[model samples]
Target: MDAVFVIKLSALGDLVQADGALRDIREHHRHAIITVMTTPPYLRYMQRCPWVDLVFVDPRASRFNLVALSVLRRRLHKQHIDLVYDLQQVGRTRFYKRWLFPNGSWVGDVPGCSCYLKRPKGAAAADHFAHHLRQAGVSVCHTLVGNVGWMADDVTSLMRQAELQPGFVLLIPGASAEHQEKRWPHFAELARHLLDRGYRVVTVPGPADLAVCRAIPGDMLVPDDGYYDLFVLAGLAAQARFVVGNDTGPTHIAAHLRKPGLALFGGHVSALSTGLQHTCFSWLEADDLHKLPFAKVWQQVEQLMGKDF
Candidate 1:
C-alpha cells in the first residue's frame, strides 16, 4: 500500500474512542504511509499520534465551496490513495467517497462497499469498530491501549506550584459543550467527599469546563490560564491514586491511561458504547445524569480507591 487515508474529523472524544481501530491500522500497515483527515481542534492530539503519518485538516468550507472541495479532490488524486478508511462513516465522508474518491477502495459503512463491520446485537462501539476492521481483513483485537507520551517536566512544575501530591485524585467534571448533561452536577460534592476522606482533589478543566470548576465551593486548583495541555493532563491522571470524571475527552483519556478510574455516565449514551476498555476502570450509569446521587458515586470512587482512600 503506497498510502492509506482515514477520515475522522472533529469530536475529540470520538477520536479518542477510536483508539482500537487506529491500532489495527498501524499494525496492519506498518510500512505504509497512514494519513488522517481531522479538524483543527484535534490537531494537537493527532500531531503526537504514533499511528498516523500525515494529518490533513479538512478545509472548513469544503461542504458548500465547490472550489475548496475541488482542491481537496486534486490533493487526494495527486497522492493516489491506495485505500480509504471512513472511520467517521457519516454524511460528510460519504460525500467524499461519492464525489472525491469515487474509485477508491473503502472499508466502512458506505452501502455496497466491499467491507462493513456488522455490529452485533449488543456490541460496544469500540469492539464493534474493531470487529468491522477485522472482518474486513485487518487482524485487530477489540481492546485498545492508548500510548500517550506525557509531559513529565511540565506536570512536575505545575504539580509543585499547585501543591498537588502523588496520591491526589483527579476530578474531571466536564463534557462536550453540547452534552453538558453528561457533566454530573454532584462532582463538587464528590470532590468534597474525597477531600474529607483525607485525599487531595484536583480538577482538570477543558475549554467548556472552567465554568463548572468555578462554581465549586472549596479550594481547588483550577487552571488560571495557559495550563491546558493534554500531555501534562495525561501525566497528572497517570499519577492519581484514583480518577473520576464525566464522559469527556479528558475523562476518557484518564481512563485510557489505565488509571484506576470510574467513568460515570448518564442515560444519554451507553457506558459500554463510549467508555474506556480497561480492566482497572469501571463504568457507572444511571437513568439520568442528574439522578446519579453523590452517595452512590462516592461509593464507586471508594471502591476504586480502596486502600488509597
Candidate 2:
C-alpha cells in the first residue's frame, strides 16, 4: 500500500474549508494509507473525519529547536511516505520540503517538487484547492461543496437537554479573539428582533466566546460539562434552521453543513476569499462592522428566512 501524507496545520476555519479537498484526496488514493498532519487542537476533530486513514499532531516547534526538528524528522522517516501533499503552503512547509523531505515526491508550492500547485492570482481558497487537486490528477467535484455531515454526532439528546426545538435560528455572535473587528456589534439586537418575530434563537459559544455570546439574548447551548467543543457545535449547526455568525470556525462549519445561513464579513477579510459563501449560506460584507446598521442585516435575515419564519 502507498503511504501518503497531507500537511494542514492551524485555524479551525481553514480546516473546515479543506474538507472537500480532503475527501477528494481520499477518493483519488483509495488504496493508499493517508495521514493528515494537523495541530493538537484539531487532532480529535480530524480523527472523526471519514476521509482520512490517520491523523497526526504537529507540535509546530520552531526551526531553531534542533531536538524537536530531529524528533519530527525521525517520525517522518518511520512512515516511509511515498508521496506528500503540503496543503499548508507556508514558510514552515517550504522549510520542511527543503530539509526533511528533500528527495521525496512532493506536491505543493515548493520549488522543484514533483508537482507544484501555483495558486492563480485572485483565486478564492476553494477555487485554488480545486485547481491544485486537478493538477494532481484528482477530480475536483466536492472541492467547493464540502460537507461536514460525518463530523456531526447525535445531537438529539443535547437538543432536548438544552430545551431547543427543531427550528431554532443559530446565532454565533463571536469571532476569533484577535480579530474583534470582524464581529458585528449588532448580534444582540438581531437576537432581539429574531425573538420578537417568534423565532427560537440559540447561541453556541466556544470556550473563549462564552462571555460575549452570553450577552446576546438567546438560549445558550452547552454540553453537560459547560463547554461546547467543535463536534457538538457541528451537530448543533447541522440542526439549525438558519445560522448567522461572524467569519469564524463555527460559521464555516455551519456553512459547510449546507445550512441556510449568513456569514458577516468586515474589512479584515472578504467572503469571496474565504469561500464561506454558498448557495444557501450568503454573506454580507461591511467596510466597518461597527457602522453597519442593524436594519440592513435584519432585511437580509428576513429575505434569508423567507416565509418559513
> lDDT scores for all predictions?
0.75, 0.87
For model 2, the superposed segments whose C-alpha errors exceed 4 Å read: none
* Cα lDDT, model 2, residue 191: 92
> What are the per-residue Cα lDDT tens digits for candidate 1 across 76-157?
7877789888888778877887888777788877776767554565456576676677677888653355544332224787
Model number with the top TM-score: 2
Residue 267 CA displacement from its true place in model 1, Å: 1.6
lDDT tens readout by residue for model 2, 83-166: 998888889999999989999999899879999977765566678888888988989878889998887878998888777878
lDDT for model 1 comes to 0.75
